[model samples]
Target chain A: MQLFFQHLINALQWGSFYALIALGYSMVYGILMLFNFAHGDIFMVGAYIGFGVATALAALAALSALALPNWVILVLTILIAMYLTSFVGMLVERIGYRPLREAPRASAAITGLMIGIILETGNLAILGAQRIRFPSLIKTQVYDIGGVVVTNKKIMIVVVSLVLMLALNEFIKRTRWGMAMRAMAFDYVVIPLMGVPLNTIASLTFALGSALAAAAGILFAVAYPVLDPYIGITYGWKAFVAAILGGRGSVKGACLAGFLLGFIEIFVGAYLSSSLRDLIAYSIILLILVFRPHGFFGEPHSAKLRL
Target chain B: MRKGLLLVVAILVVGLALSPCAWAKSKTIKVGINAPITGDIPKVGEGSKYAAEMWLEDIKAAGGLQVGGEKYMVEIIVEDNESKPESAAKAATKLITEDEVLAIVGPQASSQAIPAGEMANNYGTPMISPWSTNPDTTKDRPFVFRGCFLDPFQGPVVANFIKDEFGFKKAAVLYDIASDYPKGLAEVFKEAWENINGPGSVVAFESFTTKDADFSSQLTNIISSGAQFLFTPQYYNEVALIVQQAQELGFKGPIVGSDSWGSAETVKLCGEACYGLFFSTHYAAAGATGATKEFIERYEKKYGYTPDDVGALTWDALRLVQKAIEDTGKLTGNLKNDRVAVKDALAKIKEFDGITGKMTFTPEGDPIKCAVVVRISEKGEFEFYKSACP
Candidate 1:
């Protein structure tokens, strides 16, 4: 039982990265009715941007000119990286997606995939093939509670992820931009009739999603501290699955499903043979999706109608 | 009409610019390097390339390889396999057919080397794998050869090291199911451990796929199972993550690994978390002498980091190929006969002195070599521990 709790703690932290990135996929899918397949590469780009900004700040601090602590520099790195990466997300949507808006959905999906390849290869070309090590921002302190061991970084990751999700929930509930997004999801033609520009909502959605992915990227760096060009490929795909399982256009569903997927993967690997973890975990998820095709919080409506 | 004429002229110019292979002389021996140059393990590829280049430079300085009193300069052509098995086969085929090289050097990983070795066998070209240790890499292929010992051999080396040095019977294993090297090494180690320490001595056995980054669940089980030590034979990237995660789970026992953990990047990636871990490797830089020491200093000067076992094995493979080419008496300028001669010569190599150490090939083309065990000190350096010979 104690071992179960220990794994649960790990599952929570692991799920936070998925939940954070999945929100980007769910939101972009919800608002624009287009899956940002490049979102995973965007997450990768965000992590690299985080690495760059964090490295610069750490170097500056090492100069002893700023007299700033590591934690303060880390906070600044996360905020700045998110802001810069949001523009990248917007640029991708603008140049890549906007050109194919009137084209077939397959074209947009293909464009997203192409953009993903470009980002990955571009990073490889620019940075060379060497893997970059993310500088440690916060000192790890292990907190022993009964038999379960938890690190300060793990707690911080979980808490920060929840806080970001809550903030996003509040923004979507209370802001006019959130209202515009909701209207766009329901009917794009109707949203323009309400005097809100369609392009503005699309860009805003991409921006928001990219920012969340940036947060997840920075948090992942905090835990793993090893940054490679291709780290986002598998991570992005798994989060996309979480986004779908949570239900289309449902933020709450994405969060819940992300954690659920993490729990399933962890428990399966722990209780059963780890070799069978993905086989059984993904199979269970497939059964759930088979019964509920629209997903847990998805509406029984066509995606075209939502667009 | 003018645009069309200009386009035709441009095509002619470009075609002329690219057809230099048609005018190449056959005086020099053409060697193909089939390494993974651009994908997941580019560092491994880069190391192999540099090692080959370093040997070529030294060979040129010594007035090239003498065959029947005729000296032939070596020319190396590198092809990127993109780190995939099919890509490796395609690269090897292209090297044999298009480039028409005499002998080839790599396809470093077992997954690539196994398929590429088969292709070399089909083409009747002698190919030596620098770092691939899986038994299947050269099992049935007479034309194929390897520089490193088989995974089965290293498995007992690690198991016996832990038993004799650490004296730990109870152990845990976590491996990558999708990877050929890690999976093969893990199975061999488990069998050896059980045979030496008794059956059911392994308390926990877990696995993850190639795409997995989180290993906390498996670590939790291993910790809770009360195993005295852990064995993970995955690549350096995965090993770095596993070590960090293992430490966070409060498992303080010694961690044992394979040659895959012998890279300098493991320390850079994992920081202090990988300190004090032990692994069986090809060569250790500490306490080295003669050619091994010289190779280490030159490699460290050329590349920023110290040479790992992969780099050393690649150097060994290059020297072995050069020696085989010279031992065949002459190139003869006949591709088919020369390739056959090289293959036969490589088979007859009774002994080879390499930077990795002395090695001799078995009838099956696998090397009978000594495996060195190294430990990561508290300062995060690979310290020489001991050597295990078969």
Candidate 2:
């Protein structure tokens, strides 16, 4: 029972991060009937930005010889990171997504791939192909949630993710632009017809989603604390899988899928042999795709990638 | 007049460029270095090339390489493999068949080195891998020999350190399964650790991908599992991230790793977060004795940065190969005899005081080098601790 509870804790903690990432993926997919192949990279960008800003601030403090307090430095660095990452996300949408909006689906998908490569290669060139560790907002501490061990980091991850998610949910549901976004999701032709301001909405969606990813990236650093150029690629792909598994276009589904995916992974790794864990988890995902092709919670896709 | 001058200058530049390979007589024996010039692991490839270049310069300046009855200059032909396995194999094929190299020096990563090893083995050409620590790269391959210890040896080096030095009862393990390196290291570490401390002491064993952005989940469970120490055998990139996350998850206990942590990138990436983390590596620049000072000085003069363990190993590999060629005095002869002579010479060699340590190869083709334990200082630099080969 203790082992089971421990595994459950493991699942919940991991699931939160996965859900946060998947939320970014699902939101982008929802707003633009396009899969931002680079969303995962956007997450990476956020984390690297966090790492860079923190390091630079730390260096500056060293130069002045002030030796700033850890928390003040950390918070200032994270805010800078969030702003920079959101800007990058907006830029990606502008340069990468804008040109191909009206082009052939193949071209748009190719452009998305190119964008993915561009983000990775750009990161490689700028960051020099090394992983940079991001400083946590605070030091880690452990606590118990119902006799199951939970760290302060995990609690922060869970709380922050929930807050951002709720905020995003509120923004979409309560706002006028949010209604238009839903209308656009229903039909793009009706967007301009309804004077919904399509471009602004798209940009806002990218910004919001990007910022969310940035926050998630920060929390992830706080939770895990390493930033690599290619990290986004793996997490992005997994988050995409989560998004699809939970019905890619649905915000709730994406979040649910993320948590579920995390739970499955941790539980399997805990129960089954670690070696078999990856193969089994991925195999189960494949089986789900085989059986329901539309994912467990994913809606009947108008257009989606199964490959 | 302008056109004629331009043509003449172009011709002169071309001639100058071609002089190295074109003006070379058949008397010079060429060694090929296939390097990972691009990609995430470029530093490893770059280090190998830089070290090889330095060694080449030292050997050439010393009046080339001595062949039988005459001295022949050692010519090194470097090809960029771009860090791809296929590219490495292609480079090997091109170097052997087209460039007609007497022997090859590199193809760094084990995944790349294996196929390159196969290419050399097929042609019976000697190839010295500088830092490909995966055991399979040399196992059963007649021509493939390494200048570094295999992952199995290196991994257990740290695992035993964790068990014996720290006296840890249990360890939480995390390793990237995608790499033959980390995969192999993680396995060997488990075997060695459990052998010493018994099984079930490892409470949490988790695997991650090379591209995993978040390892906190794994670390969380590890933190809760009551494991006394953390064991990770990961590349510099992953190690940086792992250490940061590990530290964030409140893991202050000694974290032990393999030689894969022998990178400045690990320090740069982890920064102050990596303080006190320990790893077993081939070389650390403390208490320099024997060839260590000489290597560090020469390398610093050339590269302007401190040489890491991999760099030291590659330099040693180059020197060892050159020594074999010079001793045999048959390196400049027909490719067959030179190859045979170098291979035979490498096998018969007993001892060399290398920067890493006193080294010799076992008949089974593993480097008999000491693996040293190094601790990451508070300022994020590696300080040497101790070494054990016994």
Candidate 3:
């Protein structure tokens, strides 16, 4: 039972990273019918940017003897990284997707893939081949809660992720921009007819999703300080799967599915053989998808009424 | 037509004039350097290249290799394997056939070296793997050789270290199942550990694929098994993540590993979590002496960091090949026969004192050398702990 509780905490922290990134995938797919494949690489870029910001702050503090707390430096890093990465996400949408909006859907998908490659190779070119280590912002303090040790970093990851998710939820529920986004998701044809600038909403959706991914990237670096150019490739794909499993356009569904993924992987690795972790975890997900083809919260679709 | 005929005649004269001069002044010997210069572990490849370049400069300054009373200028042709097995084979083929190299060095990882070693054997060119310790790398291939000790020898060293030093009876293993080198080392350690501590001592044996980012699940099971020690035979990247996650899960037991864990990146990623962890390696950065110490200082001066085991072994490999070439006594100017001579000379190298230590090759082409045990200090540095000799 104690071992079970320990694993549960690990699962929650792992899920937070997936859940945050999956929200980006779910939101972009909800607004635009296209899956933002470059979102994962965007997460990687955000993490690298976070690394840069954190290093600069640390250096500045040393040179000037800035007595600011480590937590303050960490908050600053996350905010600056998210702000800068939002522009990167917006730029990717404008240069890569906007040019091919009127073209075939497959062209846009291919552009997403191309953009992902460019980001990965571009990071490699700029950073050179060495792996960069993220500076530890918070000293690790292990707290034993009834034999279930929880690190300060783990608690911070989960709490910050939930706070961000709730903030996004409140923003989408009450704001005019949120209303415009919901209307656009319902029907792109009627959104522009209602005098809502479709292009602005599209860029806004990408910006919001990219910002969430940046936050996830920063949190992930906190837990695992090693940063590499290719770190985003597999993680991006897995989180994309979480987004799909959560159902299209459902924020709650994405969060649930992300945690579900963490549970499945953690439980499988614990109870069963670690060698079969991926094989079994993915098999269960496949079974779930077979029963619910459209996903946990996705609505059943029929062929649209043709002209 | 007259101008064209004059141009052709001039080209022929120029080529003819340069050919004999090039041959008489100094014939050049090409050595191919195959390494993973652009992949996940580019640092390992970069280290090999730097060490080889240093060796090349030293040889060139001494006025080249003297073979049968003739001097031949040494030239190195390096190709990036891209950390792929097929790419390594292709690179080796290009080196042997196109570049016409007399010998080859590197392709550090076993996965890359094994395939390229076969190609080198087929071409009859002597190829020395700087860090590949898999027994199969040189099992039946006469032309294939390595600078590091094999897993069979090093595995026992680690097991004995745990049994004698720590006196631990319970051991758990978490290895990369997808990797041949790590898997093989893990199996070897399991056998040796069982032999020392008795059977059924390995409580939990778990595995993960290569490039796996998480290891909490594996740790949960290992921690539950009440393992006193953990043996993970994996690269620095995976080991760093494993140690970090293991610490997070509150598993406080000592972690023991193979030589692959001895890297500069290990401490950087694992941080304070890596302190007190131990591993067996080819050489120790701390308390190094003689040629090894000098090489480390020179490498640190040139590369801005201390050389790891990979760099040290690569340096030794180039010197080993040079000694063999000098031992051959003659080149005969024939590629095929000259390659055979080089291989024969390498086979005759019984005992040689390298920077890594005194290396003696067994008949199977694996080097028998002293393996050092190192510990990660609280300052996140690889400190020399002890040495195990065979």
Candidate 4:
């Protein structure tokens, strides 16, 4: 039972990253009907930006220039990094995607891959191949409840991810922009005819998704704390799997499927063998997709497919 | 009269250009350094380059290397392997066939060294890898040599060190399955541990692919498996995450590592998490005496940091090449014969004392040396703890 609880905590923390990044993929696909393949590199860029911000803020605190606490520095780092990385996301969409909006969908997908490569190589050129250690903002405190072990950072990561997800959920449900996005998801061509502003919705979707990915990136750095240029490749592909398994354009489904993916991976490694963890975990997901066809909350083929 | 003068001037210019090539064949000894200067492990390449440069400075100060009776000026041709096996092989081929170097020094990591060593052997050139510990590196290649003990030797060294130091009976092993070095070391360690404490002594054996950052599930299983210590033979990048995660998961026992944790970046990235942890490596930079201390001091003064095991071993490997060249009595001015002479001399080398250790070449071209257990002190220095030998 203790082992089970420990594995659960581990899964939740691991799942939070996928959930957050998958939300970006889901949102972009929701409005634009194109997968932003570069979303993973955007996550990498966000992490590097957060590293810069956190290091600067930490330096200020150390020098007594800013009378800020560690938690305050962390919050500022996340907020400032998200703000900056959103611009990067918008720039990528403008330069990489906007021109391809009228091209074939395959061309747009290819553009996303090219943008990803550029981002990764650009980071390598700027930072060199050395791995950077993310600053430890919060001192880790381990708590053992009975036989299960947990860390304060893990708790904070889970809480922050949940809060962001909830905030995104509310944004999609409450505002006029949210309604415009939903209408765009329903009928992108017709919604623009209703003065929905297609370009604005697309850019806004990218900005929101990038901001959330930045948050996820920072949280991930706090937990893992090792930053590398290629860190986004495998993670991006795995989260993409979550995005697809969640069904197209279903935010709730994407988030749930992300967690489900995490749980399956962790439990598989724990109960079976770590060597076969990915094999068995993905096999289970493949089985589920085979039955559901369109995933848990994915809609069946409808008139919306005409576009 | 004017045409004759022009012809004489042109002939003089041509002779001046061709004179150096004629002298270079016998009067100068050319050594090749195939290093990963641009790719994944650039630090290793940088260290090899710096060590070669420092060695060159000494040879320059002495005017030239004295071989048999005469002196020969030395030249080192450094090529970047880019940390890839194919690139390493390409670098070796370029060095041997194009540059016509008498000996080759690096391609340090086993992944690069194995392929590069094959290239050197096929060309019948003497190649010595400073840091490659995999047995396959020099297994059947007489022309290939290494400055470090093999992995098969290192495994038993670490196993005995752990048993005698802590009296631990059960262990857990975690390693990267995709990488050759870790996978090989992990198997050797597992077999050695089980041999000492009987079968089923390794309570948990876990593996992950490369670029994996999370090891919580594996740690949880290791913690619950009743193992005494955790042994992970991963590189520094993964070491920071693994050690920290294991600690956070309430695994109180000591975490052990192999020489892959010998990078300067390990302590820098791992910070206080790795302090006081133990790993078996070539040599400890802290508290050295004699030639090792002098080399470390000079290298630190020149490079602005402590030299890692890669730099120390590279220095030793280059010096071994130098000794082998000198032991050949004289360069025959024939590339093929001189290369064969260097190989034979390298194999016959006995009791060659290096900054890393005292080495004697085995018939397989591997060094018979002791492994040192290093403790990362609270001040973030690799302090010498104890020595383990076969």
Best by lDDT: 4
For candidate 4, write residues A195-290 as lDDT tens digits.
Answer: 889999888999999999899899999999999887788888889889889986888988999999999999998899888889999999899999
Clash pairs (backbone) in predicted model 1 = none
The candidate scoring highest on DockQ is 1
Off by over 4 Å in 4: A300-307, B1-30, B38-40, B63-87, B90-101, B329-338
In the order shown, what is each candidate's alpha-carbon RMSD?
2.5, 5.6, 4.4, 5.6
Q: TM-score of each candidate?
A: 0.96, 0.84, 0.93, 0.92
Cα deviation at A79, candidate 3, in Å, is: 1.4
Tens digits of per-residue lDDT for model 2, A78-122: 678777887887888899888888877677667777888888889
Off by over 4 Å in 1: A303-307, B1-18
Pairs with steric clashes in candidate 3: none
Model 3: CA > 4 A from native: A302-307, B1-26
TM-score of candidate 1 on Cα atoms, chains taken together: 0.96
How much is the lDDT of residue B161 in candidate 1? 96
Candidate 1's docking class is medium
For every prediction, compared with the true complex, DockQ reads 0.72, 0.26, 0.60, 0.57
Candidate 2's residue-wise lDDT over B49-89, tens digit each? 88888888887787876656677777788998876677888
Query: Model 3 scores what on Cα lDDT?
Result: 0.87
- Error (Å) of candidate 4 at residue B32 is 3.5
| TM-score order of candidates, top first | 1, 3, 4, 2
Q: How many pairs of residues in model 1 come into backbone collision?
A: 0
